[model samples]
Target: MKNLKPMLLEVNANPSMRIEHEKELSPGVFENVPSPVDEEVKVAVIRDTLRLVDPHKQKKKDRLDHDVSTAPEAGLPSLCLKQVFPKYAKQFNYLRLVDRVAALFIRFLGVKGTTKLGPTGFRTFIRNCKLSNSNFSMASVDILYIDITRRWNSVGIDHKESGMCWQAFVEAFFFLAQKKYKSLPLPEQVASLIDFCEYHLAVLDEKRLVCGRGIVERRNALVTCQTDGLQLTPAAHTPLLNRMATASKLADYRNHQY
Candidate 1:
């Protein structure tokens, strides 16, 4: 019998998105030095879609028609609100813009492959959440996190909130930031957890000379609450979402759950 060891899983953190800088490759593509994912645009698109269906209907397969009726009518197949919204629909045209010039500071520590949660090495990275704290595994999701992290840092978003920042984002949502090439903040980390959907999961739109359409301007300012008087604002109202989870919740979710 061939002594068989388990095979490692490979995750494509930096999937090839061929948009580059200065040197134009095609007629339509622009030369973006830095890229950031347009979180607002993503939110706008998703909000439009959710008008009809629950965006998080994971169990339901894509078979039924949830028509929104906005075309020639007769020939049009069943649709969701995603089809109706124009700005959101046009968003795909700017996939290249996801990596803005401001998104270059991120440092991606490459790992071999997606580490199995069962392994002892993943103790910290896979601790309370899906991964252990110290576990250094390379999954596709890490790429998204790297992108988003650098992008957010550029635009002045140090979000340390509950829903938008912690539970829905953090480790679970880091994959979106790991693309390494282009990154941006996402609108809805999970479906129901998000209330307002100005955009789905996109970076800012910096084309056509348009700046700050859907996003709330987040300057690099942290509201300092002294030793006592720190009034907390809700995450829904702010553009910051890069916060760590509550201590007890994090501890319970990671170290104590077992």
Candidate 2:
């Protein structure tokens, strides 16, 4: 059985004429689609892109700057934005921060009684946020790999529960994302977070942490498990930590030979 598409047509010809026309129209599969060629044409017209290699493409705009295939109608050129601006992207620390913030918001949604956030709820909330990009660089705010291991972002730990909420929230994110498929339409909160991070540099970075309640109160207790986790030092930091031993050996060899 084929369902007829109800058309809201303006009738100047008269009600009887409209009814007669409706009756004449066949109620079948062919009438429903109306155009197979249009659908096929659309499927075939999928965008094809060329990958140009240029380290300094952003310095100057050229004739090929605008992707003409996509748009000749609009005058503005399609800006050659890099997918992962490795030079400008931040480190895992920034991701950790984002994960934490996601956690805090997710928690509020799943709280049972007093609106307190939990790990699972925060995780679900993040699932709903629908972060579009698979690559993390789109979310960073610093000079890419500044080694968050340094003692730079530790200030202002007393203002709000932001750090704590973030910590738990991040856990939930990883939990759900490991082996699950979230629904289609992503939630506005996720998009909002991504948009906010993409535009505002300081809010995500500790150096320029947003100086307000909305930004500050969105925190969580800095869980001990989360600490030193994103530090990409080594499978074991201890073996690498013993660099002095190798240096001393070289020094001993030089001394003995002399």
Candidate 3:
């Protein structure tokens, strides 16, 4: 029973449960301790620490990290006007177009540092800025707006709090420019359009550019054929005769001609 008692004590022992006093009391000395203020302080400290390191909160953070890593737009850099619009890289006036758009965006919202716009705000911007005027038809403007809205929604942006960034405005502007100047050669049209809106280069996508080059090549081929007045249809292949029959025909033709 004595050995069992010592084993029970060992099993019950916890280092953290034991509190050490800074000052030791002498033998036969008794000091009246104050109210459990020190103990209360220790309990509060432990409670706060537990709250801060809650397992549930840690799990939520981990989930958020995983979502961010796996998101479709994960590796894409924040849309930058200069990087996307390389054609206007050296032009300060063109680069300032980003600032101009940003300023107007925030001004319309009446909120400082707010760079995003909801669907209604975007529509208002187009109307107020006269973006749909002149060469840009209302139908095309609506289409562009819908396209931007769909893209913005696909990224899981909450419409209640978040909206499309200013970069989308630049994209829409360039889209309209392309529509307006559809007849001109692509490079020449782009160059001419850039003079009006310095940020026109921002609309170009690498994949779209590759596809455009293919279309341009085909167009050039068609134009060449037309200029030469060549038949549009492919020439029919001549059927091959037997080798012996071909040789005899050639010999007969040679003899008859000579």
The numbered model that scores best in lDDT is: 3
For candidate 2, write residues 58-126 as lDDT tens digits. Answer: 344665586655554345333333344444456433434465455345444543433334334433333
Supply the TM-score for candidate 3: 0.31
**Per-residue lDDT tens digits of candidate 3, residues 86-157?**
545576454455465455556456356566666676666565545566666667667777788568567755
Q: Which regions of candidate 1 fall more than 4 Å away from where they truly are?
A: 1-127, 131-141, 157-258
Q: Where's the lowest-lDDT run of ten residues in candidate 3?
A: 3-12
Candidate 1 RMSD computed on C-alpha atoms after optimal superposition onto the true structure: 29.4
Each prediction's TM-score versus the true structure: 0.15, 0.17, 0.31
Candidate structures ordered by lDDT, highest first = 3, 2, 1
* lDDT by residue (tens digit), candidate 1, 69-183: 4323335333323343345756653342223211211111113332112112222222222331233445433543445444544554544421112222333333423322133
Error of 3 at 88 (Å): 16
The candidate that achieves the highest TM-score relative to the unseen native structure: 3
Q: What's the lDDT for residue 165 in model 3?
A: 62
Q: Is candidate 2 or candidate 3 better by TM-score?
A: 3
Q: What Cα-based lDDT does every candidate model obtain?
A: 0.34, 0.40, 0.57
Q: Where in model 3 is the C-alpha error above 4 Å? A: 1-91, 110-113, 133-140, 156-162, 182-258
Among residues 3 or more apart in sequence or in different chains, the pairs in candidate 3 whose N, CA or C atoms overlap within 3 Å are: none
